[model samples]
Target: MSVFNQPRRRIVVLIILGLAMVLIARLSYLQIVEKKYQRLADANAVTKKIVYPSRGIIFDRKNRSILGNDILYDLVVTPAAVKNIDTSYLCEILEINKEEFIKRIGDAVKRNGRVRPSVFAGLLSAATFSRLQESMYLFQAGFELVQRPIRSYPYKAAANILGYIGEISPGMLKTDKYSDYQSGDYIGLTGLEKTYEDVLMGQRGTRYIIKDNLNRPQGALENGDFDTAAIAGKNLRLSLDIELQVLGEELMRNKIGSIVAIDPSTGGILAMVSGPVFDPNLLTGSSRTKNVSKLFVDPTEPFLNRGIQATYQPGSAMKPLTAIVALDEGLITPDFGFPCHGGYTSCKFIKCLHSEAGHAANLRAAMAHSCNSYFLHLYRMEVDDRKWGGVKKGHAKWKEYMSRFGLGHRLGIDIPGESPGIVADTTVLNKRYNGNWNSCSELYVGIGQGQVAVTPLQMANAMCLIANKGSYFLPHLVESIDLDSSDLLKKFKERHTVAKISDTAYHSVIYGMEDVIEHGTGRGAQMNGIAVCGKTGTAQNRGIVNGKAVDLKDHSVFVAFAPRDNPKIAIAVIVENAGTGATFAVPIANLMMEKYLRDTLPLSKQPIMKRMLETTTIQLSKLETSKIDSLNATTGMLTSEAILKKYFH
Candidate 1:
């Protein structure tokens, strides 16, 4: 009793006060600051049903719905609600054994806990749904059929452009970026679907329902005051022409390459096709898992969008650009000439198509005939200009001009997985030549070989620049998104101008391109009434096997723009392993141009369309090595020799 002094009593009282403050502060945080515990506490009594909004409909240029939505039924289960019922009957309905049924239940419980509902079986077929619908009342205690909306392609066109969607993966669920997403949520995995997901996927709503101790629904919680209505996703209107897309796919059928067409003025994509054409329907519904696994192992890689993803040496198609760069740099004039006798005399290995003297008398004639020597000489002169100091500096300057033309990089197209095709800078050139290179060392680039590589999309965009005389809009897929005020399309709307070349120089280039379709190598691309400016390219894509050059088929390529003055459409076509550009690419391009310009093919051109549809340049040996050949076989895609004979003969 004597030890209990006043100062000691005051100290004990202060300690008690501090302890009370900490307890109060922590309690406030749990009750007022933390929302997760509150939701969990609410889950004990209130069942929150998520109201999923309908995904946006994707429309083509003509307001035709290419991509829409369809309903799929999923079998969902609540482990806590599972009760005394015919377990054997349920297993029979699901076509699963006892072990599988137990394992699935355990998986569902472990995934989302016993109190919450989880998907036991997803993407149920119509037949299964019909069979289960009649007896759903029997299993009402634990199981329910929930309607899930899925992407549907009505025309079955633009598989690579529209892309596919799937359930969110487990790994994505734990991240803060995806904390809003739940286990059963779906997300766009690629293409325009993934690029505009935020606009395409609308706000999700919630409905609170009161439940009994047995987890059976009692009634709406608080007379549905807590309920929020779902907001449907915004619609997407694209610049794509559905009919053009269909025609492109048909023309490109059985081939391994791409076709890209764009509107020169607006830079809107008209059509983009990556062949062999894959059915978008296969990547949706219950068959998606199996089809995806098949596609994953396919050697041909149908999943790759060749229009933007695959790169190639542009060949002679790059000559016009070479000339434009040289002219713009004041290194050459429109009338400048280079004498040729079968090849470039300086670079003896680089051959020319014309052996006649004075074939390269002028720029227009040289380009029309695709004179290798003239363009090569032009590239060397431009890069080795005295103003640029040396080859390295000149090359860097040349590269800068190329970038302005939208080469050597992605054009920021609306789709994902677009490759920034190789445009060798000094660093790459140094590495390739061990810092001992000169303009002559990379002169083959003038002919679009060597260090230059470009995608079909890039080529098409370059065509747009040429058609517009060194200006272009960013190539874009979506034209507008409903209710969008964020100016997502501002970048595409701005005009980008490159190069300060004179109008006379443009005239020479345009005139040369006109000659190409008129009477040159690209004559097959000619249209009777329209002024079609085009260039043909036969690009080498080979390898060194056993330290020796391996002989392989060259890729056929063509780039063109139509009606020359105030040009409307710009296009690029590539056919892997095809012979000459005139053989496959030029004809396909001509057909596309005629269709777009005239809006109908003349009766005389019917035979050309027929022949194109029946052709297959893809070697059968290559097809046999892929899972696509076997998988496509199931869908009446004839991969056998009979098809080859039928098409070729």
Candidate 2:
């Protein structure tokens, strides 16, 4: 115990006191100065409500609103706050029984905890909402009404294209893909709705409301300091011409097929029509679920979007593609002719459709006449050409060319559910023919038959390629998103070149197509002033029926691009179970072109339009007969008589 020890003890005591004072100062600052803890305590008395943003509207190319929004009311309930409210009176207002009311309350409690609000009845009608609004005050803090937005379609056309929004499923709620979504949220189920879902579904906001002791919202919490404003979704402008869509749908009534038209300039879809389509309004509002069930079970499959989903052998409509390939490979000149004795010498499976003398002709004449033997010979020569090492190598090169044309792969269209048409490669051929196959083994591909299958979209796109002479933009439905940021559509705006072939090769093929409409198999598609370059196809059909292989009627197909020089529209039309390509499909294409280009049909053409509108190839029952007799009486041999003679003869 010296004097220095005493000084050290005093210093230690002073340091301890200073540390204690600092701790007290920090506690005082935290308790009085900061509002974090105060907000935490207030959270117990506040309710956070999610504010759903309104979905964007959809407009056609003409700026017409095709889809719009409608206000709907939902009855919500908090099971814990519910008291001795007149159960019978509430049920009467809601159009439900007392037992059903109890069950709904129990369900709400099970779905969301007792203190949370849950939907009791959703998408209430205007009359029901009005009735409930009068009695809403009597329900007290337990029941409340919330406003929601629902979709409405004014045009009632393009149901398959516009698609429908549906409630989120339990599985979707669990998946990471829908992590942002909660229960009771609506999501796009198919078509363009599903494609642009993220952009169309805007950011959801939150609002904090002060709750009283009875759990009723008193007012905005903290004067709305913590509330975030909801953002409306971005709008979408489509390339679809609603008027043309309506006309195409009308022309395809009572038929089973599809038609797709694209603008050759920008590759924007003008019209996409699938037959047996229902009014788009049927799949909206309160009756959506019921109508969906009916459409699901319908034998005709009205839900199918045949334009990009269904695949078929394109028939002679593929001749133009073959002609281009042949001319590009230096395999034949535009004037190269092939002799045909009514059928191909290498293979007897395909027969010439033209006269024997006419079958011995050049590419343009062969295309004009749709001579099957000519194209079959061209396919064999290209595959057997000695420049490529072998048939396998040559087939691979051919597949590469087809893939460039956007075949054998998805075209990356904005819409969902697009099927990549089949183009046989070396491996596919080897597997199908057991590696011993030769050029003749897959010769049917030359005429766009056998293993080759294509969607109506692919056929139209192939025509687009020919129309543009080699390059094309990706076919797209949505033209622009939002107001000024078309940069979001960079993917579709990029130009894609399928073939590097010379323009001369394209000219040869294009001239052949022009001749097809001028006086060939596709003469039915000819217009007076518009020069339509086209090709007709009658695909052989074989399918399993009643557990046996049967020969069904050929599929009628036609592909064309108008004004041969500066093409505006490229189109493909298909009619299933129809007799010939020149019968039902060509006339439909002719009318579609006339409507789109001229914007009106001439008086002389009204009778032809009437005849087309009246024809029904559906054949719902064997006892039901087609209106081909009526078509024959009005449109002469071009429609029914000549097609029937060619098929049965």
Candidate 3:
């Protein structure tokens, strides 16, 4: 002290004070501001259990539970905590060898760090769970049974619309959409489950318990003061009619197509059925892995939701739209006549079913008869009109009308992976024909052929607008969520108008469709005491086999709206390779409409329903035989023909 100068002494004292202050500040930050350290400290002395709440329940329009959840147990393990224990006893219970146990433990440590827990085995059978529950004390903290909810379908229908849930992938865990989810968590992969996942997924909670030196739970920490209780997920209410759904599935049992029926008044989907559907229960429980593997490999593609996924040429079903567009454009009147000599001669020689004197005498007659020549001439005249300037411009104008009618684009239904069927415009035409194409070059489009294609959803939605006389609500599945109308429900409730077409033009089209069911080609759809308006379609297309075009059977299609005055239901049906629309599509659609309107089919129609149930139109290619066999062998599914005999015959 005596050797030190006064200024140097002051500087040294200040440095000591500064160091003391910094040390105090860091100590305060660690002790008061940071909780991770406290959590880690508690982790060493306490047991943390994740509490999973029950997933949301899905109900139909009648307040019936369509999709529900059941409790399942999974064997979980923590590698770091797996200390001195009877490894062989655990192996015996799990039915595994010592080598497999070592390998699985190593895999668990590698997948996640030694400190974190992992799923050693999942979806334990009830018998295994019961056996393990009685002797869980032996495994203590390292191994535990975790309770989770798995989906259960009460009716075993609407598999396509409901979709399935799967584990979160490593890639998905990194994304912000799934940031809240962790490894081994489940998420909806498709359909309504995917659409309403945010509302359907339950919140997770944590329970902390004090533990002894042996990692055995003593009691709740601080009398459960810091523990949060698990809250069950919100439930969802749908507009789907479960009874109608069951019927539709039965009717479409042996076919390879889809049917969609909508309440035109509210735009609520009544029934959406895709054939070759599997029981949704197959995707849950212990057999889930094997069933999912088999389903993913099946040749018929039961996973494909044909209602909104499959696209087909509208065929004669599009004649009414052509008539409406032409009438709106002032190109044709209600009484406009055409002298079609069994074919269209102006451009392509497309044959017509009706060549009588007055068959094409007016819009109603032409549409009633599904006269191809009449609609083709209408398209040519509308496209070649000077008002649109040129063929390209005229064609673009026609496409605009088609777009307004929800053609050539997605109608925005509440589902995933929807297809916008083909609707060619000027740009597409120019690219295909090098800008030298004229209206006559694509005349087949007028008859809903050539470049025109549509989904069963779109076809049904179009019928909705036509049924409303000008406007329609967007077709949707969910009606409300937990008795509350969400923004999605609000959007579906809004009515959208297609165009400013006169009501008279719609009446003309409606009259023709009515005649189709009453006395024209769609007479098979006739019903007593009901004014049904319908149209038939036989779509021609070629399939590809080894890069060659093969002549495939024509697709049968039908579109209809029943009780014509105040329309109740609008429906569209398609049966692939089923020949004439009157043969397959008409009967199915009419029966569906009858069920929706009358709540049941009469005794007389029972025979017709049986015929539809036992019939099959699926023609598997040689290339798909092996794949189909593999699926049948591995999945225990019946053959395409045998499925009908097993369930209905």
Q: For each predicted model, how many residue pairs clash, with residues at least 3 apart or on different chains?
A: 0, 0, 0
Expressed as tens digits, the lDDT of each residue in 514-610 for candidate 3 is 9999888799888899999989999886899789999788999999998899999999999989898999999989888877788767777766776
- What TM-score would every model get versus the actual structure? 0.90, 0.89, 0.91
lDDT tens readout by residue for model 1, 1-649: 5434678887888899999999999989989886445644676677777778899999999999999999998899988878886789888888889899999899999888897889998998888888889888778777888888899887777999999989888898989977888888888999998998888888898878777776667888768777898898899999999988877887887799999999999999999999888778888887789999888777778899999999999999999899999888888899998888888878566778898877899999898889999999998998898988898999999899889999998899999999999889999999998999888889999889989999999999999989998899999999999888988899999999997788899989999999998988888887887899999999897867689989688999999999899898999999999978998999999988888888877666666777777777877875777665455555554333443343334
**Could you tell me the lDDT of residue 91 within candidate 1?**
85
Better model by TM-score: candidate 1 vs candidate 2: 1
Off by more than 4 A, model 2? 1-45, 211-217, 483-487, 621-649
Off by over 4 Å in 3: 1-40, 483-486, 620-649
Alpha carbon lDDT of each predicted model: 0.87, 0.81, 0.84
Q: Looking at model 2, which ten-residue stretch has the lowest summed lDDT?
A: 628-637
lDDT of 2 by residue, 264-299 (tens): 899899999997656776666666686778667666
On lDDT, who's better, 1 or 3?
Answer: 1
